[model samples]
Target: MTPTVISPASPVELLHYMITYQRYPTTLLICSSDDEFRAAIAEELKGQIPEEQLQQEPDEFGEVIIDHPLAALPIFRRVVARHLRVLFVPSVIHLRAILSVFSQADSPIPPPPEEDSENTKQGARPRPPSLFAYGFLELHRDSSEWSAQGLSSSASMFVAAARRSGFNPVMVEPKAAGGLANFEHVLREHAPILSGGARRDEGWQGRTVEVRRVFDRWFRFQTGQWDIKWPEDNAS
Candidate 1:
């Protein structure tokens, strides 16, 4: 529930979630160690999003990125802090870096890691933001075989780590030919956690208690014996 979903159509779904789900200005963060795939994804995004919306500023939704593995996590931390909403599609290596924050058994929103010398400006103790940006991370399966016996072919050591760690990525599968529309519907189903307005305090007393439920869910994630939630236990 770290505001990231895992699916095959991640880049497409990330854009769909950002633009179609809400009007708040957001950033599309591309995390890659090289420009090998960034350019192609950028071109594809251009076709779906208007030219004006791609401007990288607070006034408008925009596309931003980190092409360095070392700088990816620190920069992403800053981006999510600055922008109210951010939909990031990160390379696998970069994804792990972004997710490492959750593994630390310390503060929920701890300051940037010590290794990030560039984050010296982020004060000694930064207060956690009330709300967070949501997005997707693409799951890629290399042809490598599982070292553990009897595990499914899809379950590699890395995949198992993802399942147990604080990465806590929600697994989503695209329906056959369901297209972006189907994914949007599914996102609507998961909106309690994914929506930017999820943390809004106004009119909470009148709502059907979704806000309270959200708080309990987060509390469970922080205090539970296992930080990860089984996909089948909560949802199909």
Candidate 2:
């Protein structure tokens, strides 16, 4: 199935929709070559979303960190078990590496043999469940049509990998002509509403409907019923 491209009208609208309409287990994972953008997003989401809902890759304890992407399989399995809904990947390179791991049809090597005798007294570890209705964030340098095409190619690769790994993936890229400043502005504007105890505007509901339409398109695209065209360029 061809992947559908989504270009949100604005960052504020996207955040509003995510916070208001997204289902439970709504965790966002941020990964980047540097932590600047991730830090910015975390700062913006401070009062808006609960601190527990946002998580960083590698984590504070360095438990999930891995030198090779394939080594992260256990971590990915755990994240899926936890039912994380959103993953904000800022680094294109990191995103590609993760996708490569998922693209594998099956494990290349056999599982380690179970311990004998004494180990039989202990129970085996539980496995992670399948992921569903998950979202991924992609940040680009500009909003040009050329950039959009490049993003489409990346999204296609991501969706294909996710499907192969037994996940239903939806990619979202919020429009911000003014770049980071614009994103900050939008988040600030909606901070009050996101913090709670305020009536939601009718316009926010309208935007939610619009965003839902985008997700519907993604769902339809996954079925291969739609004649969506994928770019020749494939993300490695």
Candidate 3:
């Protein structure tokens, strides 16, 4: 499947597309660093789809809330198998972790056996079936705090990662509710390809792994200066 990019005109239209095209037994992971955007998407989805179709609590709307992506690694397979409709992850950090897990699904590295454990005594536990087939959607909110270049670069990284992992990822940047019509118009133009009816040209070409490594190193190096300055601050 060819990777495609979607620029939804508004959040409402984006939610509509998500609810309309979401297939059964394949969960839709909506990830973003902005809590407000995440909640907004969830609220929009709840309003659009039937309440009974969703998984909610007695007093609150029930949705699978993942605090961290790495934490979900162990049960991701089970969650996908159950055919969850929507999952809310708080950050792109978690998204990266999930992508890494799926990309490495083919050759999972099992943990070392415990010393004299019952399971180890008999044999190592069998690895779970790969859960690489699932849909991913990223909704990037234009942050006033982040530069335009930063947002573009971040989006590019996501596009690259999705392409490398063979996922037809969809990304939308909805400026406001009033823009729904324009967003829907764009979606209609790309509906055929998004629905697997047509193949779009490849526009992303980058190694997500390498980009992540560079990002991590840069982050560490930038933050490491804090440790170096801590001593000076205390002395003064």
Best by lDDT: 2
Worst 10 residues of 3 by lDDT: 218-227
lDDT of each: 0.33, 0.38, 0.37
lDDT of 2: 0.38
Per-residue alpha-carbon lDDT of candidate 3 for residues 3-119, written as tens digits (9 for 90 to 100) = 333333334444444434443322344554335555564555556565565545433444443333222334234333333334455554555555554442342333224423634
Is candidate 1 or 2 superior in lDDT? 2
Q: For candidate 1, what is the lDDT?
A: 0.33
- Order the candidates by TM-score, highest first — what do you get? 2, 3, 1
The residue pairs found clashing in candidate 1 are none
Q: Candidate 2 residues 1-236, lDDT tens each?
A: 33443333333334344444443333333333324433343344444554454443657776433243222333234334333343445556556666667532343322224423424666753232122222233333321211323344445666666667645454433444334243224222221112112234432321121222323434332211112245643442
| Models sorted by lDDT, best on top | 2, 3, 1
List TM-score per model, in order: 0.29, 0.35, 0.35
Query: What would the TM-score be for candidate 3 when compared with the true structure?
Result: 0.35
| Better-scoring candidate (TM-score), 1 or 3 | 3
**Alpha-carbon runs more than 4 Å astray in model 1:** 1-12, 15-37, 50-79, 82-102, 105-142, 146-167, 172-236
Q: Give the alpha carbon lDDT tens digit for every residue of 160-225 in model 1.
A: 334444333233333322233444343322122221222234421222223123223322222211
